[model samples]
Target: MSQPVMPAPIGKRGRAALGMDAQDLSTITERAGDGLRVLGLRFTNDRGCPAERFETLRARLGTSFEGIEIDSSPGNAAGIAPSAHAVLTVSLVDEPGHPTRVALDRVVAFLAEQLRH
Candidate 1:
């Protein structure tokens, strides 16, 4: 995968999925020798479509996810530009304890979110 300098993560800044919301993010720690190392990734605006928005989002998200690591540098510089959507790909340091999956369990148990409501 590319480094944090790959693209600039940008979009609507809110409690969206895969964002700062407790419902969207998760944390993972890997064992590196004698200490633990948390993982980090670069999130760009998908592209540089809205340069201004990307900058704002990158700045805001710079320190949003506390437990999780994020990298924002490589802003889109091709046909791909910033947009309001993203294809999710989450890698966890461990299994069965990730927050995203735990939330999903609740949804699955109810068959539908409306049932939980």
Candidate 2:
């Protein structure tokens, strides 16, 4: 069997834009609350994966997935790293709708599949 692929590390700027500090990103693999489902991913700069990829992913995921980028702070002394990190928020249409654990799983699976190629 193939070993599971680990996500790349995201930079400081990317983390802030996702409205997450390193701790939040570390403890929670995924979060479903409010009207949003948060999915996190780390990518190296060499991958050439730009912010547009998130939009494309959202489109491919269909209406169930909505991408949101929020401004956040560093939250700690950890300086920004050179790598890139991001959180993809998939908000459901209904009230109190958030991405369920299953949905988060699917998103991660989809992202893993995409990254393999």
Residue-by-residue lDDT tens digits, candidate 2, 33-72: 2223334332223133445445443543344344433222
Q: Give the residue spans of candidate 2 off by over 4 A.
A: 1-40, 43-47, 66-78, 84-117
Candidate 1's TM-score: 0.20
Model 1 residue 82 CA deviation (Å) reads 0.9
Clashing pairs in 2: 10-84, 10-85, 11-83, 11-84, 11-85
lDDT of 1 by residue, 1-117 (tens): 112322343445322223234432222111222232222322344242233333433433443312211222345322222332221233222335443333334335534633544
- The models' CA-based lDDT, in order, is 0.31, 0.36
C-alpha positional error of residue 93 in candidate 2 after TM-score superposition, expressed in Å: 33
TM-score (all chains, Cα) for each model = 0.20, 0.24
